[model samples]
Target: MEWTQILTLAAKEFRDRMRNRWVLAVALVFTVFSLVIAYFGGAQQGAVGFRSIEFTIASLVSLVIYLIPLIALLLGFDAIVGERERGSLDLLLSLPITRLELLLGKYLGLAAALTLSTLAGFGLVALLLWQRIDTAGLYHYAGFMLSSVLLGLAFLSLAVLVSVVARDRTRASGLAIALWFFFVLVFDLLLLGVLVGTGGRFGGEAFAWLLLLSPADVFRLLNVFSLDDVRTLYGLASIVPTSLGSPGVMGGVMLAWIALPLVVARWRFK
Candidate 1:
């Protein structure tokens, strides 16, 4: 738990990603996609240009949900396993660093890279739209960016856990993609299908609790509930309970998603 050693390892991880151009590639992806969505997302409605921050954020939420988790998984799914395959894991373990410090260092470094890219990508768009948005709109956009970072960190934690448990990088990657698919695509559909088939008998108040299981959903609720226009646009006004919609609640849930996986990964790595 020595801060100096942890920070040194974290700096090394960050530098490795930089040397590999991982940061540049991800930052470019974020910037391009965000700019496109901000300007052209409303084209179907015969609208084009920098629309309201609400609409931009709403569109960005969908993009972040799909993109961030995949990037995080790709970035971290092989963190441990790849090292092991390269014969570096044992060498690193032989150093003066404790396992907890090593794990935390790696996580911090990856999280920093993700956060920097996310902010750079989305922050550029926010700058472009700065003059177009009001104070409230700016606040909403900022909140969206923060939550997007949280979502990435959550998935990265999962990837770390996958890396810890998998026998090799191939299996780690497969598990990471499966994790993304389950949380992003399949989980909600299955929940809805169950609710429909059972006619609300199976999932009553518990339905909302179920949404917390998926970090993406928690991120969605955090953003969607913040803006009135976006809330109604998503048709979540009636379905989402007031208590569960609180920023405090959703933020806590997102933090839990980030922490729980890292805890498990720490245990497994040990």
Candidate 2:
């Protein structure tokens, strides 16, 4: 409710990240990985150079699927718990800001840092691809960048939730990594195991809806379903119905993924 207090806290948090060069480091990592993928993504196909935006995005999607979530998780897993471990949580709580304002400030500051890094990193690639891609390609590539930010924010929200729930930084980090592995690595495999073990009869039509459980999958669908060529390349195109593939629908699901975790975190923190 107190904008000044929240903004002050947020500014402090953001400045800490800047002072420590966390934002710069993450941005550089994204820049290097993206540039490499864009240019050498086709090396295995006996070709090496910047390909079409579609192909570049496809390769980048796989990279973002693995990288962004982990980065976001590590960045935020210790937000509150780290404060507690350093004996600063009580000092922060003694401030005039309400707990809600404090939580929102922390989350917003971290989100801003992540968003800036993502945009700067990928925006550089967008600039490099400007001459190569047409208007349509620009549109698709822009969408990919936006969705990548959302995916990171959603996972960061989960990390904040973990920070609130765990008693210490060590447990918070362990839970954070477990969450990353479960959502990024194990969730889909488990879904597939069930679908395959049951001969697809168990998860036929409802499979697409089930993908909503993992923000990573939702991010994948958001990108893959938009492009016709890339859509076919992904098996989800067949499993995810056209109804669930709408940009608006998938975007809403992603927004929910971002919000629900924060809501739960706030409740638990209270």
Candidate 3:
């Protein structure tokens, strides 16, 4: 539809984000946290004679799993709802732009920022690692960074969808935070309990499905790039079991997850 309008609004949204001091602080915190984890974890692995590839994979996966969803939640949960609460959303809606443009522009802005941040962070880590050690893993690790960034955008869209429905920042933030906690922290624990209580009976099929439900696990699968390792680690699924699927299939699923929500959010626009 209005590509120019959408792009312009998206640019404005990106600029407006500069005024969001809290988000700036959070982004800084995320950067610091990733650096600390990477440095310390990489050092420990290097000392233990673990390969650089393994260290990078583990470090990046852990960082993205723990932090990305939180970042997405914080950034998106208040997207529309916050504006509505502040009386600015009404003014914006009163403008010439349609609701679809509003939603699309915000999503594009969030997605662009998320992508840029991950790419920049990965570049820094790659530079540091190159100075420290060389590994064939760099190539795969690059792919991991790219896929993880897309997955992070999926979570951002999920939060945006919540923001749209709730139409109030407080309620949407509460829901976003609660869901983040559930998926990040509690979901796996609950799954573990179920697996144990069932004497591991439900674990095989259930945990497989859990990957579909939990974005965190899907991200982990993306990191499992080596096919031999996928088989050794994932079993006889032919589709890279421990992973979400093979790289090709995994990419499709992750994109679907991201796109489906943005579509819904767009369609539901007033």
lDDT of 3 by residue, 154-264 (tens): 899898888888857778988999988898899879987987899878775657667667777777676654434533443435433544566776777788878888788
RMSD of each: 0.9, 0.9, 3.4
Candidate 3 Cα deviation (angstroms), residue 50: 8.7
| Model 1 per-residue lDDT at 248 | 96
CA-lDDT, candidates in order: 0.91, 0.92, 0.73
Write down the worst ten-residue block by lDDT for model 1.
Answer: 200-209
Colliding residue pairs in candidate 1: none
Off by over 4 Å in 3: 18-31, 42-51, 132-135, 225-244
| Residue 19 in candidate 2, Cα distance off native in Å | 1.1
Better of 1 and 3 by TM-score: 1
